[model samples]
Target: MKQYKLDFNSPIGIIEIVGSDTEVYSIMFSEHDQIVNVPQKDTPQVIIDCQQQLHEYFIGKRHEFTFSYTFEGTSFQKEVWTALTSVAYGETATYKKIAASIGNEQAVRAVGSANGKNHLSIVIPCHRIIGSNGTLTGYAGGMWRKEWLLQHEKWNSKGIKK
Candidate 1:
């Protein structure tokens, strides 16, 4: 499958948005400084939509995204990612809770591993998962981004602008 890519300057940093004609494949942070200037008319509709929604999200205007996404991972990882989506906009769940939700209470560490493997970042809400002790845990985007997202959601949930 041919994949299209674009770099978006987000509040946190540069985000590399890669997708196909039908669905987004991944949204990951990028350290590279080169920004592709894909004209709006030339850019894929899915990519355009994803960037717009992400912009809205960063500004606390959007609470949920409507763009379709394709997940690439093992069955267990996919299941874990799906469960991560159920975590509400502001609410969070522990790794243990996610494991139990997937009918594998013993897979707490496995769930954490799968969470770290998630490539969709904020769209998948993997940052909403934390350690069972209520402390922030690993985020592929880094702990600071995770903390910012959680705080963003918390303020947004309360109808307060942040």
Candidate 2:
């Protein structure tokens, strides 16, 4: 399937949303040092909807995303991603917790690896994953963005405006 793309100007920076007409594939930040892809004029409706949802999320008007997205990764990664959604908007979970949630308490490192492979950014809620010791860990979109997202959700969940 041919994928379409759109660029959304978010509070943190420009977000590149890629998807087909039916489901989103990726939503990542367009790093300043990288060449940003020009958005297609005929952007997919699902992607447009994702843009709207993300905008609402950034503004604290939305907590959950209802956009259609496909997990284009291994089954293990998909399982990890599914468990990630349960981490909740403001709550955080550790890799060990995620592993346990999936009935594999010893796969904490694997859970972390799967989290690193997530491509949907905030929609997947991987940023909500913290270290077992309650410290922030690795995030594919950079640790700073992960920190920002956690803080964003923490404030929004409390009905506190950022």
Candidate 3:
């Protein structure tokens, strides 16, 4: 299937949004300012919707996204991603909890691995997952971005200034 892409200049950095005409495939952080493959116009409706929702999210106006999205990964990864969505708007979950949630207590490491493989970023809430000791763990978008996102959600959830 032909894929369409759009870019959202978020507070952390430029987020590359990828999708088809019907569902979003992935949203990842871009390290460079260049527009590699995303288009400047003629974006798909799903991409446009994803962009708008992401804008709302960044501004603390949206806590949950309603845009159509699809997961393209292994079943285990999909299960880990699904468990992440239940982490709530301003809450965090440990990898061990996520593994237990999936009825695989021994998959804590596996959960972390699946998180790293997540295609969708903020929408999947992978940044909300942390280490068992309460320290921020690996985030595909970088540790600083993850910290910013967690702090953003904390303030927004409490109606406090960010």
Q: Choose the strongest candidate by lDDT.
A: 3
Residue 8 deviation, candidate 3, in Å? 0.5
lDDT tens per residue, model 2, 10-101 = 87788888899899989888875443565467777788899899989998888888889988988899999999999878999999999999
Runs of candidate 3 with Cα error greater than 4 angstroms are 34-41, 160-162
Residue-level lDDT for 56 in candidate 3: 92
Q: Which pairs, if any, clash in model 1?
A: none
Better of 1 and 2 by lDDT: 1
Task: List the pairs of residues colliding in candidate 3.
Answer: none
Please give the ranking of all candidate structures by lDDT, highest first, separated by commas: 3, 1, 2
Error of 1 at 142 (Å): 1.1
* Candidate 1 regions with alpha-carbon error over 4 angstroms: 160-162
Worst 10 residues of 2 by lDDT: 31-40
Backbone clash total for model 2 is 0
Query: Judged by lDDT relative to the true structure, which candidate is superior, 1 or 3?
Result: 3
Q: How far is candidate 2 from the true structure (C-alpha RMSD, Å)?
A: 2.4
